[model samples]
Target: MAGARFITLFVILSSACKVNSQSSLLEQFVSADTTNRAARFAYLKKVSPTDTICLNDIKRAIRDSSGDSALFVFNVDGFSTMLRYENELAQICKSNQLKFKLDIGTDIGYVDQTTGCYQDYLDLILFEKYGKNFKPDLHKEANDLYLANHLLDTISSWDCDIRPRCLSANTHTSISIVVDLPIKAHRKEWVVDKKPMFAVYHPFMDLSVVIDKDGNTSGYQLVDFIPARRQNKKYKEQLLAIAIQEIKNKYYKWKPAEINGVLLNTTHVMRLEFEAAAISK
Candidate 1:
């Protein structure tokens, strides 16, 4: 779990500018993390401060454990995974029934191939179309008040080359595919009722969720996190604890992923955005 231990943050413990480091505020926060050091077990990996893509943290992990129902990776390559193009890509994954991964690059293996839409993923990044439209990777210019927003839009008119079956051995069995619609069509999503002031700490946090066959959350894990360039390690445990709780409270589930018409357990990786403004008002 040493990998997980070093991970905490996209929760703050660094620069005063990355978060509201007021002693009164941070000291007031405490959790089981300090007493038990539980974060060591749940932590994923610390990300490079220069990287803006939130999904970069867990992309590789998702690819590895995807077979045998280890995970169901969510598509997180756009402005808001639940909002615009990311949403669209996720739906596409659902419809295609290909489980490998979306456009984001994988940490373990190469994705640029005709097997699934990885070729398209490479095309999207090489094009870098979203940067012109959304102006992502602006965290350097951000502070405690307003943070940079990374908007990724990879869905273009090329039509995904992904098919139900790919020539690659791993593609069809890949668990990195995004989960489809809810079991019940009427289930609604929850809006952020209160935006956190400390959201400026990092761009996002990677979340790992396991859904049972019944379309319910069966497991949750912290895969990776994004942090500031010079983050403060003062209230690190407290921040980690708070962020975990925030996700547990905010997450919702509708449907579990199915392949070959079998309802099986699935794991999904979600890049939880901490940049408050990235969410619509």
Candidate 2:
């Protein structure tokens, strides 16, 4: 009786594994034909009844090896259908207690030319905010950074009644310019100890500066100073001091940002690259 029971259990497990393998393969076929709703539904019906296959079950079967599921909906479908599908997936995630995120890929078409232009304008503005050292990866955190600085409200209130103008004559051409960051100097022009020198190492110095309504620097703080190369403890301090003095000697100006014709306290980031130059006798 014991031997017969073991054989029954083994047979049941083998059949279960075979079914799971076939289900997984079927899910791959469905995922590959994302744009073909009719095909996918037919395959689902072949596996099980349409009424029995819920969104959650589809999510489970088609989930990648990392245990994450992604659904790609084509824009060829009307906006209503796209939204409806998204809502269904969202409902499934909530009911199943699953973490979900939605990313719209480049394949999605813009509603109009104006919408595309508006997106480009926003990108340009963000580029001005980060200056010449803008990193594309930092765009993900831009919203949080803008919110922390209370800039969103200020930007929304900008006077679109006419072409915007700077608050002062010294205002920079870039709308979101930093007023205290050093300009890029030619290597030949960079001098130390009153002698022309070549830079052996250069690194970026990250700083934040506050600008008042008058386009003047109110305060400055260093967030980080990356050294070009490692140095002795004493030399490091000396190099840092030199970098500080160099930045302090530079001048910066930006169009004072205003909201509804009222000047607001504004803070901007400055990324200064400091080079360690050595003069050869």
Candidate 3:
């Protein structure tokens, strides 16, 4: 009777070991997503052994399935806009009894511009499921489509007048100011050197001007000065002084900016480009 009891005990122990081994295999294959690295590791460690069985089975089914036959689940908040599409996908999976992978924290508000359909978005979700096994041609096609749509959107919304124009003869000569705001300057031309080597020079100055609520000009500061050509350092200083003085002599009658019916002070940076051609012959 003792020997018979010993053999039964051995059988029970072996069976228990086999079950434990299978549970470990399931745990190894199961994937989980959490808020952060530390949380994910902790969750993985705390997962119940029974849960591994279902997770492992899903992983196996996804691996063995072909094409769209594979199923997946996106673990997102039910209130999310993505729920509508995910629910439809889930139903399809149910019909096939195909186990699916989990997608965590997916944004579903994204819609296609051309087709206005979710089919393209669904394709992306499926591609993500395949991971490294996804076809390169399909991935490239998706990227190309995205770029083409982006280009179209950019072209449609582009406003030429709002774009920054570099200081050039065509743009600088035709300065556009607000109707009430007129800029006045004392002298547009400056003599760089008055000695044996006399040269007439024109330089570009970038100035920051501030207008108060009363339409009065308040602050004036030189942001930058670019000389038409390289000259002596002392000569450049004189040119800058002349430019600042000219800007100071100028006056602006601004229409004050208002917010909620109250006038507000505003600041603007203006680039003044002076050309030698503008000088009297």
Candidates in order, TM-scores: namely 0.27, 0.30, 0.28
Worst 10 residues of 1 by lDDT: 139-148
Say which prediction, candidate 1 or candidate 3, comes out ahead on TM-score.
3
What TM-score does candidate 2 reach? 0.30
- Candidate 2 worst ten-residue window by lDDT: 112-121
Candidate 3 local Cα displacement, residue 144, angstroms: 41
Question: Candidate 3's residue-wise lDDT over 191-245, tens digit each?
Answer: 5566343444445677666655555554666788665555423344554555555
Q: Model 3, poorest ten-residue lDDT window?
A: 154-163
What lDDT tens digits, residue by residue, belong to model 2 across residues 1-281?
11221232233323322311332211221222222333333343333333232333344434421344322221111111122123444444445443334322222322211111112222233334544223222221332233344543332212111112233342233122222323232333477899886744344565566655555654566777664444322344444455445435554444555433445456655555543244322
Model 1, span 1-281: residue lDDT tens:
22221122112222212211332111211210121233221222333343333234345444554454222232222121121123433344344442324333222222221111222232223224333211121111111111111112112111111111212223222122111211111123344666433222333446666545554553556676544322323333444455556545444443434322334454555554333223222
As a whole number from 0 to 100, the lDDT of residue 82 in candidate 2 is: 22
Of the two candidates 2 and 3, the one with more favorable TM-score, higher being better, is 2
By TM-score, highest first, what's the ranking?
2, 3, 1
Q: Which model scores highest in TM-score?
A: 2
> Which residue pairs show backbone clashes in model 2?
none
**lDDT for predicted candidate 1 compared with the true structure:** 0.31
Q: Would you give me the overall lDDT of model 3?
A: 0.36
